[model samples]
Target: MLSVSWCATAQVFSPGGGTGVWRVFLDPIRPGGPFSVTAEQRIANAVDRIILKDVYFGDVWLCGGQSNMEMTVLQVINASKELTLASHYPYIRLFQAGLNKSLRELNDLAGIAVQWSVPTAEILGKGNFTSFSAVCWLFGRYLYDKLQYPIGLVESCWGGTPIEAWSSQKALSKCNLSFNVTNGDQKHEATGPQEPSVLWNAMIHPLKRMAIKGTIWYQGEANTAWHNAEYNCTFPAMIEDWRKAFHQGSEGSTEIDFPFGFVQLSTYHHRVPDDSFPWIRWHQTADFGYAPNPKMRRTFMAVAMDLGDEKSPYGVIHPRYKQEVAYRLYLGALAIAYGEAGIVFQGPFPKYFQLKNSTELRITYSQELAVLELSKDIFEIRCCTMWNYSSCKWVSAPIVDNFFNILSLSLEQCQQKVSGVRYAWKEWPCNLKKCPLYSKSSKLPAPTFIIPKNDHL
Candidate 1:
């Protein structure tokens, strides 16, 4: 065996007190001589030993977002068994990204140290609830349970931090943002700073070299509810950044695209009645199939419209039933990421729109079904109060489809008087039964459409 050595620097919090250096030493290997392993295998062994520890090294997930992303097992209901089952998998590990928010370039300790870990009963029982995304944790759990592969989760997020706070001053300066951020008692203003991409810089950028299978996002509550800006460009920017960072060899040569998946924000509580909230959700839903990365060339968004309960406490911050959220995210990963067959990843979404007769709106969608007819004829539309999950109020739904049996709408009803027509728009979740594409009622609403009320305005 020929002896070779290399040094990798890592900062580890000492169990006794302050931080210390973690020096990684690569063992000797034969030089141009016989080891049963192939060159690729040898390199992989080096990487596994030098970089990640206790990780399976196959597929890894970068779980991101705000408080939702940081929500963990202990706080969730009945999470003990779930986490206990998760801990058995030696391959699955969770690495927490230590929080750091500063304008300066972050040093090496900015990102999470590892990919992910299975939670132990002891860990769950102790219930630190310090730094984990509840929805993200469950989602990773689902992936580990189904794939039975080594899964790693890198969590980088902060609670109550808006899109602006997460962005760098440099990036924020370029964009026309609207939020006011205070840096050391001095307030700086911009149009909404590019969302998410900011956090990605401090928290995620350092981890770029690490091999990852995909990312699971649970943000948008802050950006959508707070900024309400058109995120079409910013959301894709964040995705592209991740793709460029992770989809390369050390030499920066390979053009690789892993699956990028995210969860749409579930409904939350609101006091007053309002419509049109779904427009932002529409933007998020559109991201599933729409946000194309020119580099990696693929993106996906998991639906959470159905995940929220109309009955959930109003104005409450965190909602339960994360297992379902995890399972659906897994389904998206299974079908879109890992190439599983026969799974429905999303319901019908509006793809194109046209105006006919000046009184109706024509819409085309990705999924085809007979529900357009049902929604028009029966019109048994139900309105959900944020306070009532067990029941709903019946309302009239008109035949909204136009021209192509694809989608028809009443041009007269939605005519010049309608500012915008939204399918399901609310801060909280809604239930639509027997939707055209979904076999069962979904907690989330179908993809909503936005049309100007005044035609010429």
Candidate 2:
């Protein structure tokens, strides 16, 4: 067998795993001689070696997720227009990898497993390019346009793959997970705590010490199914490990923390009147709460609850408006990564609600309010705090008919007298009245209002 070598001097290939420069020489032509590669195989091997060498000397952006991220330009709208307008920044490169699970420790450089390429129709259709993570490409393209930097997008996603399969065996062992290391049982394997640090070992470990601004994630739909408990810790742990690995140590002894943003799973699965798996949606929503660090905790979640169409296939489990998804991601990046400081990536949420004098529900808000302009309509306040705290739902301001959208909640429908109000707290029908203005970007509704059972707020 031919053996490859890495040395400072010129490469000279030797037989039997010897340590020296690798030189391509034919083996002895005996009856049992082993240098019998077909002409096609030899050509293929030579081409792959050339590509591998090229990839060794470049930077890449790693993207991992399920099929939504894997959706392609042809699947979404304006494919022709988008391709015609595709003038890629030369330095901004793109790479993709298979989303295979590894029971064993992956190579240190898992993140840089593929070669970078320019965005051309031919390049995109080369391998499994149609399944490349589209959201990542859109985000990178946008960044390249605005910043004019050398951006590299690495698509490391698989269609219909669960988050557990992508995790590391070592990490999963800590979480008490079990899955067949062999025999390809994805379903049986996904039932356990995902192998922890698998992505780090395969994707992040390889790129450790590589200078990257930050990472943007668009996954967790699989984790939403049955691994909520494990995800609670695994998600946070993954963020920390990535931080430590890519840490450049800029802020004194404290390593410089980078912004890690993610796309919020949209509300396409809302099947009202049927309460099956409601907890899954809730867990997906909670993932929005995870941030990288206390300092650069610059994490944003784009709410896609209203963006999805009801007619879209629920059985498919894939979001149809992928371009919109990418745009929403870009919105978060612009606000958090680029620091626009002007827009709200999602709607405002109610912090706490209170009953006042046993009469009306007093709802209070947290942080800065963005869509209060929508509240200018009736200018009149409702007397009831419309909230659904039992299931952790979001409530949008209620609008009445084409005239007035309800602003505040002051209700008299509690065991005692209700004193606070909320909006969009339950799974309800859409009322365009809920939102008034045509937001230039994604509009997040206010939070659920909370009322103390005892005192007034």
Candidate 3:
């Protein structure tokens, strides 16, 4: 027999399964638990029993992404101190999904790399790129410090995997993409798992039944090779589909439009100049250069351009300063997910631009700006007599005046009228925390952006 109970209500059902498997549904329960569940079966004189102990109910967050999210605490900066602090938070539970892929959606996880366990120094200081994730752990720890409750973190991540691997076929179809692995795809050349929907099948789909409060991602580097342009559509579609699937699977326990958060792509090679990284950063927010936009609603972003690690043992592409990244993410979560009032989670953005004169352009920010001591040639302008992109070249637009929220630029180097303007348009724009512009209140670096010529401007 199957039974459902909550408070004073109870419903019972007769055992009607011939395959020897029975399922029961329970209503949603409040958070905060160290409860237990037991099951028993009897046939004639024989009896069988099973029990699960120390189970908890809390805000469950699914941390998904590539290597950065998989980077362990042992590989981060101040590793010893971080590992020592892990023992203080017993309410923060951790689970990691093993690396596996399937061609079809699965109802259960293929493997469990690390079962739900309380954090400890030994558990947190595991092998690099292994069970415990630095970003995920630090984020959960910060949340527990604020909410003062249990926080469940499930890590489903694989290094060098593209966003396609995490997204389903239904989601990809919306972006005009399919699961067609070919030799011509450059993104799959030197890769492990690049096939679409494989990781989703084995890792993400299995967790649909387990209701999650939200998700945080740290990917897009793998897609920079080829799918950077399509990410504006593919990424948003994937979020929408994941929300719908989880809602249906959990029977409305999870919100349809839960608060989604992600870390923007950090710097790669410092000396090597490439536009791919900047383009992918823009596309990460659906090309709006920020989150919670119309295309990607109920979302927040963490900018990591200023926290670049150029001398990391793992690689420059993988920054070791995950503590700052997780702290920024926690701020966003507090504002967007928890609905805390008067939280400035994001940095200042460009509100508008004005042509003060033929050789001068004024850019106004969305909030009060802080001019760092190291501010320099981080701004550029494209100028041409006609709309000929080939003839127009980008020249340094030095800051002549900066007051409060307005920044005035000198365009004397331009031979003709400026066609567009851009800021910090480089893989490595400046030294660590030396970015020219930032929000005075939040202390967060302004995200890279490009504004082309428009009629209103």
Count of backbone clashes for each model? 42, 46, 0
The TM-score obtained by model 1 is: 0.67
Model 2 deviation from the true structure expressed as Cα RMSD, one decimal place: 10.5
Candidate 3 local lDDT, 1-457, one digit each (tens): 3222223223333466244423555566677777766555656687666666777778999999999999999999999988889879888999989899987788889889888899987777779897589999999999999998899999999999899899998898899886543334433443447788889889999998877889999998898896789999989999999999999988888899988999998899886768899898898988888888999999999999888888999999999989989999999999999999999989888898999778788989988999885344688888776666667777888988889999998888886868888888889887888888889998998998887664535
Ranking by lDDT: 3, 1, 2
* Backbone clashes, candidate 2: 46
Q: Pick the candidate with the highest lDDT.
A: 3
Alpha-carbon shift of residue 389 in model 3 (angstroms): 4.4
| Candidate with more favorable, higher lDDT: 2 or 3 | 3
Shift in Å, residue 246, candidate 2: 3.8
* Candidate with better TM-score, 1 vs 3: 3
Q: Estimate every model's Cα lDDT from 0 to 1.
A: 0.52, 0.47, 0.85
